[model samples]
Target: MSTHPQSQRRLHAKGFYDEFPRKGGTASRATHYCAGCGHGLLHKLIAEAMHDFGLQDRAILISPVGCAVFGYYYFDCGNVQAAHGRAPAVGAALARCLPEAVVLSYQGDGDLGSIGLNQTLQAANRGERMAVFFVNNAVYGMTGGQMAPTTLAGQKTVTTPNGRDVETTGHPLHLCELINTLPAPVYIERCLLTTPANIQKARRAVRKAMEIQRDRRGYAFVEFLSPCPTNLHLSPLDAAKFVDEEMAREFPPGCLRDRTAEVAARPAPPPLEPLTPADIEAVLDKCVAVPAPPGLDPDFGTIRIKMAGFGGQGVLSYGMMVAGAGLADGRHVSWFPSYGPEQRGGTANCSAVISGSAIGSPVLSHLQVLVAFNQPALDRFARDVEADGLILYDSCLAEKPTTTTARALGVPASRLAIEAGLPKAANTAMLAALACSGACRVASERFSDMLAQTFAGKPALIAANRRVFAAATEWCQANLRPE
Candidate 1:
């Protein structure tokens, strides 16, 4: 045996975790990719580059929904798994918000080229400072062997068993060529992973992209012609041979555009200053016309309310009025609206949450109060009211809705609004009923101020709504039992 010193063996990259406990199996040291997959090799190249650059602390990897979706399990940096086709948008947000972050978006051909094509192009067009690594394996390797946007013209996939027909499916998308047409991208390249020399070239391309990110240079995209042996129904060697011969012919590997030397580094954005209480008060004073009530209680607990009706019935407006009143009472409030496509004839609904403490979410599943403007609204949402809660519906509804758990009341809101000389003020009447019945904890006297603030520029509507509110309150007091 020769006495020469043996070359030092390479260890795992420091950018990765010592152990992937998230995998939850004995094979924690291995990735989830199939045997002889190119993803493992590409991941190593990226992690090694990150480690060398000392960017492991500032790097944030946005993983997409594909075989590599488990990237968070291996990468030791900040990891966020975005929804399928939304990685580019998420990456853009992180780049803008965290200027010091080295944002990296990892996506497969199916995720980036198909559903996420628009997002990818838009982000590139805006010249977002990030690095995007796109893997084009010809076919959808993760979800069975389906045809992808990068699949060759005559490639045979499960969806295209007879080979992709250009007549029906159109021509395959040349993504690098498409991106090269844009002016904002600073670098665009395509590399291969078939041979050892080609793999080294791909490593150079990966390192170059990360260097661009380190300098805060605008948009760098690197596409890799990778192998997928299991999906292609071929041995590892045959798959690499296929990529070397057929795939390379379709997507030639080389740099299409490189302006890294010409582009200057972007300046880091100033840190965001936290808003002070006085700053918040100043903004609220300008936005909110009605001042919060003096000496208001801050520990009123929480109350949830839902309002539903036809689109033209102002159901969403009623929910907003309640939310606005809660705000004026010095409580935390949230109003969320849901409506159909049609402007006037479709169904509409909204949820309102009022609390003295912090509100976690604006969505409400169960309600302390349900206000329905029509029979359909009552039938659909009456059962969602709590057992000790209250249900109020328009008296004009065709039939009275029965509820076994909660007390029910029929308010002549429409008639009262008409009598008060404005049919559009019916929403104000509903608000008055809710306040007078004690269903919501807000003071009834605050509705007049809320209406004044809501119609700040329009004086006539404010007077009309106040009349409707008074009529509804008086009617409820005389006829409906508070119990």
Candidate 2:
């Protein structure tokens, strides 16, 4: 008689990926976590909970910039790898956007307690609908064995050579205690994974947190007091003992807050309603009719403009005026500004795109019209203009560009603004010159209208800007040709 084969009892979660492969096409069944590390155990617990709750399909896991960064490779559910300490913020946003989806933020002690402390705190205080799993290993494990915020007072790390200095670094932050003070979070608990019994308790906490998310409840946090054997310079057994004894003495493993009984499940958000073409047209029709220049090429699909100057020279404002004019003309527009470190002395630039059709990208590599408000601005952006493009430079700048294949026009913007008794209206003068020279597709009258709208709050300056604009337009008409 043939013997019946015994079935294997599967312990691994079906939510985990079949295998984690290296970039070079090699598949490895083993994880990168060190032996006796708590990450593998924690990952298993969370994955199993997700599998049991049937949340794998609706789950979105946000992994922080630490050892858990490779969570995207293992978790079969949706994964978003966030910047250091920003997992909570990202998870909160994902939860809000996908109200029905279960969002999980997985972070290490350094990522959550150090640089990302503010983000984590704010998310918990807001009672965002999500689950946060914090693994407190008391050391920065990914970059190096550097001192983490949760590093024990006498613990030795790369930064804390002899031991942690409480006077200078302060005591290890009790995250659950701090977060518990907030009124928003529905559940806040701390658990350990050192012993088998502790592991069972931790697994239950993980499942409970996931269950709250499945029920569409408010914020829930579970911190795992885990072991770092390699960094702690101890064997697996010794590390487990350290977590159970010394670490637990500082960070007692138990529930700090549990309001699940009092809290009600949040209602499911309304489904998104699609808009028809007529609805979109009704919205677009509200734009003011700013006429284009006469005899402008109807085939002109898009125009790319780049404006650059010193930060205080209103470089961003000039680009905004151009974009505003395009919008007033019922055209699609985008304005992107780039500023250096200091807002005042730093270099500032902006790219404005006006398109008859949908604007695909705000970034511009080559410019159709380049406006430079100073010598530095001219020198920096002259090479980026197209061969047949137009370059409008301030006449006060002595440095003339010679490398560009574009046609260059010099405008006395500063002198003209001063002549109009408004030294700050230099950018307005350049806008007028751009219209008068016919380098831009928009009509000169449309630019004047935008100037009126821009300075509407300061009615006294509107008259001075219009005068400066007229003067610059006259100068451009006489001196420059319409290409």
Candidate 3:
């Protein structure tokens, strides 16, 4: 009779498991961990906590390797994979970078102890505002079973064939004991999962730590003594008993320390203010379109142009320069690419749309101008030109000529650069030629202004490129087009 009776579950063969939410969140993917793993149980508890506390949006999970590396695969939150044992450090940096975000560092014993001890201790000492969920099973289950830093003495593991040694090996480091010593630690508890009752207790601790994070409290750490039956060479039931009798003795179930008073002693963080309308107006970055000249006929549609060459040929900058020239002329402009596998040490190509109306997409369509700087580039984009559209290519064309009806202008860019006494200014030379060609709507004064804006900071390079532009414009007016 009740419409909202309870939270529903889609039952699988093993029974009803928590259904992963398919909604708007950073982590919307299903997990891929093995069966009977503690991670899924813990993930469910954490997700429920985040969902209940309404801190889902501000939460970021820092996943470290071992079992919890793929914690990002389930938690519907902003997730980042931290380096092994470095989740604390990652958590610290994230807390510092975006302090508003509630950082959760999830790590295993191998990740936190064997390799990441320094990072863990340092982060704890720093009083970094983060919540750490450490699943300690006393063995590294990921890369074959090996004795971990928390492995109890006389525990027979793969690495410790004759069982652990108390003298030569040294005593197992107690993380709860170590973290308890740190002044900034808000909470530290060594919880176990040997029994269903204890699982509930651990879950409560987990929820409490998260609640602290929700209230903007300082550092909180909860270590779960998870079961690893496969690595421990015990049946599931036997492993549960081993954890209860053996593991629980060494790692007693109690609170190491609580600094909630310090949290209460501190003043609450300031609330965020609303954004004003004027502030919104000032922040908008509007890119004005290029305009047409005073004397030129405005009948022609905006001219689209393409520039292509090897990686160092300055195709992107050249295209931007041409587009900037159009911008100065008061026309709308957009620049994009036709780049392929040639992008890596091979040729590069860019297309620019200089139009009177707003551009739909920045992708260069077929039947526009084609400017190719290499043989492959010319060969690749030659036939795609429109009947009236112009084709500009460097004299460095080392391939067979195309007989396309589109008007073609071949400027010996390399020769022009050599004559100009600066070789790298070749692309700038080709750019100037395109400007003087009657096809584009950009005015001469704006073109010069654009050249200044495009190369404003570099004076020597600007002078060199200016020579190239001037020379190319002179050559185009003299030989290729009628003024």
Which structure among the candidates has the greatest TM-score?
1
Better of 1 and 3 by lDDT: 1
lDDT of 2 by residue, 1-483 (tens): 223333111434567886765221342545667788898899989888898889999999998887777888788899998988998888878887777789999999999999999999999999999999999999998766899999999899999999999999999999999999899998899999889899999999999899899998889999999988878888988998999998999999899888898998778797556689999999999988876544333466789999999877888989999999888777778999987522124578999998876776899998999999998788778999999998998887535679988988888899999998899889999999888866667776888998888888999888989999998888888888777
Candidate 1 per-residue C-alpha lDDT over 1-483 given as tens digits, one digit per residue, 9 for 90 to 100 = 333434111335668887766434574675667766788888888998999899999999998887787788888899999999999999999998888899999999989999899999999899898899999998887777799998898889999999999888878888999999999999999998778999999999999999999999889999999999987888889999999999999898899999999999877788567789999998988884655544334568789999999887888878888899888877888999976432124578999988887777999888888998988788778888888888888887635666547888889898999998988778888888988988778887776678887888998888888889889999999989867
lDDT value, residue 54 of candidate 2: 90
Model 1, residue 168: distance off in Å is 0.8
lDDT of every model, 2 decimals:
0.85, 0.86, 0.75
The runs of at least 3 residues in candidate 1 whose Cα sits more than 4 Å from the true structure, single-residue gaps closed, are 1-11, 274-483
- Report the poorest 10 consecutive residues by lDDT, candidate 1: 1-10
Model 3 lDDT, residue 444, Cα: 64
Q: In candidate 3, which residue pairs get closer than 3 Å at backbone N, Cα or C atoms, i.e. clash? A: 289-331, 290-327, 290-330, 290-331, 291-329, 291-330, 291-331
Q: What order do you get sorting by lDDT, best first?
A: 2, 1, 3
TM-score, per-candidate, Cα-based = 0.57, 0.56, 0.52
How high is the lDDT of residue 414 in model 3? 74
As for TM-score, the candidate ahead, 1 or 2, is 1
For model 3, residues 1-483, the per-residue Cα lDDT tens digits are 233435222112111123433221442334444444566667766777787777778899887887666666566688999878888878988887775788988888889987999999999898888899988888887655788998999998888999899787767879989998878889998887667898888878888888778777888999988777768877777777787888888888878877776676333455446688877876764645557345233464667788888878788888887788777676778888644221124457898988876666787667468778887678767888887778878876545356688887888877788798888777877777777776676676566566677778887777777787788788877878653
Flag regions of model 3 displaced more than 4 Å.
Answer: 1-31, 265-483
